[model samples]
Target: MVVREDSVETKHEAIELVLARLLRLGSLVAAALLAVGLTAMVVGLTGIAPRLITAGLLVLLGTPVLRVAAAALIFVRERDWYFAFFCAVVLAALATGILLGRAGG
Candidate 1:
């Protein structure tokens, strides 16, 4: 399809779209990481070695923490206050769990 220059939108709109898509992609990746982490943690906990389980839990927790920080950066740049706030809260909760898990271990 042939499009005219005047018929197209400005660079800023395209940039915004790109930023939002990037954020969405990040969110998806984070979600996947969290899921995998949780599964590994569960498997380790139920399996033979206690040390392995603890290590698995720690690694699993790290992925979400990383994801949240990355997402927050994107949200802040995009001026998405709501998303930023949500991710912040989620990160805090995950951190607390990590701390408690370590303490208990």
Candidate 2:
């Protein structure tokens, strides 16, 4: 059976959607790794336990910060409103986390 033109277009769109999601997910993972690696390095350099623990917590909680920051940069460059909104919310959460973590510390 021959595939219709509309069917091909729909398939192509679906593939693009999947690719975009994968790219975003990959970005999030990479950002998490970067934050974790940076924290680990700082912990290794400094022999302070509480500071190290704080850094670890910050890295863990800041994963989304990196993710959103990456997305925000992309959205800003591309002028994407919806993604920008997502970035705003994620950044707000990151800010809240920072405030709470500081207070607790």
Candidate 3:
């Protein structure tokens, strides 16, 4: 069995590539949804258009959050436990804030 070792820089670069792809994909999906929503609205199909718009907005909002989560997973893969733990903590805090905000609303 052969195990290859990667330097920390290489690990970070790998994660960056993954994050870039994720962002690009998220942007594309959000744009498509927004376009559809706009078209629907223009054509007087009011029912689903607003829902699609909201969904697109949500995807745009969630991209960075998902990126952070992916970073945590990549850290775990690279055996960087400290970074992984901190990222997890950050995610937890974000989730708590969202929950609290919703409850208050």
Winner by lDDT = 3
Q: CA lDDT of each candidate?
A: 0.63, 0.62, 0.91
Candidate 2 lDDT trough over 10 residues, lowest sum: 10-19
- Candidate 2, residues 6-66, lDDT tens digits: the string is 5555544443454466556666665665566567666674445445456556555645555
**Candidate order, lDDT descending:** 3, 1, 2
RMSD of each: 9.3, 8.5, 3.7
For model 3, the superposed segments whose C-alpha errors exceed 4 Å read 1-13
* TM-score for candidate 3: 0.84
TM-score winner among the candidates?
3
Separately for all candidates shown, the number of backbone clashes (residues 3 or more apart, or on different chains) is 0, 0, 0
Query: Alpha carbon lDDT of residue 53, candidate 2?
Result: 53
Please identify model 2 stretches exceeding 4 Å from their true place: 1-63
- Write the residue-wise lDDT of candidate 1 on 7-97 in tens digits: 3343224445655665666556656655665676677644434444455556555554566677777677556689899989988898898
By lDDT, the better pick of 2 and 3 is 3
- Model with the higher lDDT, candidate 1 or 3: 3
Model 3: weakest 10-residue lDDT segment is 1-10
Residue 27 CA error for candidate 1 (Å)?
16
